[model samples]
Structure formats: structure tokens, C-alpha cells
Target: MSIGMSFGLVFGLTLFDNIAMGLPLGMGIGIAIGASLDADAKNKGKTI
Candidate 1:
């Protein structure tokens, strides 16, 4: 979330734009990626 906001600012976006656009997008993507990895780990454990 902070990463995304920083990136937006670095790229010349407004502060409001950073929060409105970056935070939710970054957090959602992060959550999806983490969920995928957790599911993969569980599957690997089951196989083993």
C-alpha cells in the first residue's frame, strides 16, 4: 500500500490519486498473490 502510494507520487500523480488508486489496487493484488501462495503450499503438503 505504501509502496503503491510512493510509486504513484514518484510517477507524478496527485496525493488523492495515489490513495484512491494505489492503495486498494495494491492491497487487493497483494492479498490475491498471498492467497495463491498459501493455497500452493497447502497442496504441496497434501501431496507430500
Candidate 2:
């Protein structure tokens, strides 16, 4: 999610200084979390 990406970018900038690494890492985590949420929502018969 964009939220995660932004957070990651900020975190990376604050802690490390690697925009490239931070963006992808954050994107991956966001996608995984989003997928999990989506699956859970679908199982619960809800729309996300």
C-alpha cells in the first residue's frame, strides 16, 4: 500500500538512507499484508 511505502521511505530515510531498498521492502510488506487482509475479508463475505 502507499501508506506502507511512505512509512518505509520515512523509516529508511531516518534510519538508513537508502530510498531504493526501503521502497521495495515496504511494497513487499504492504502487498503481503494486503493479500492477507483481502483473503480474510473474502472468507468473511465482506468487500474490501
Query: Highest TM-score, which number?
Result: 2
List model 1 lDDT by residue over 1-48, tens digit each. 455445555444454544567556666666666677789989888541
Which consecutive 10 residues in model 2 have the weakest lDDT in total? 7-16
Q: Please tell me which predicted candidate would have the highest lDDT against the true structure.
A: 2
Which portions of model 2 show Cα errors greater than 4 Å? none
Query: lDDT per residue, candidate 2, 1-48, as tens digits?
Result: 887798779877877888987898788878888999999999999988
TM-score against native, each model: 0.56, 0.77
* RMSD for each of the candidates: 5.1, 1.4
Clashing pairs in 1: none
Backbone atom clashes (below 3 Å) for every candidate: 0, 0
C-alpha RMSD (angstroms) for model 1: 5.1
How far in Å is the alpha carbon of 7 misplaced in model 2? 1.6
User: What TM-score should be assigned to candidate 1?
Assistant: 0.56
For candidate 2, what is the lDDT?
Answer: 0.86
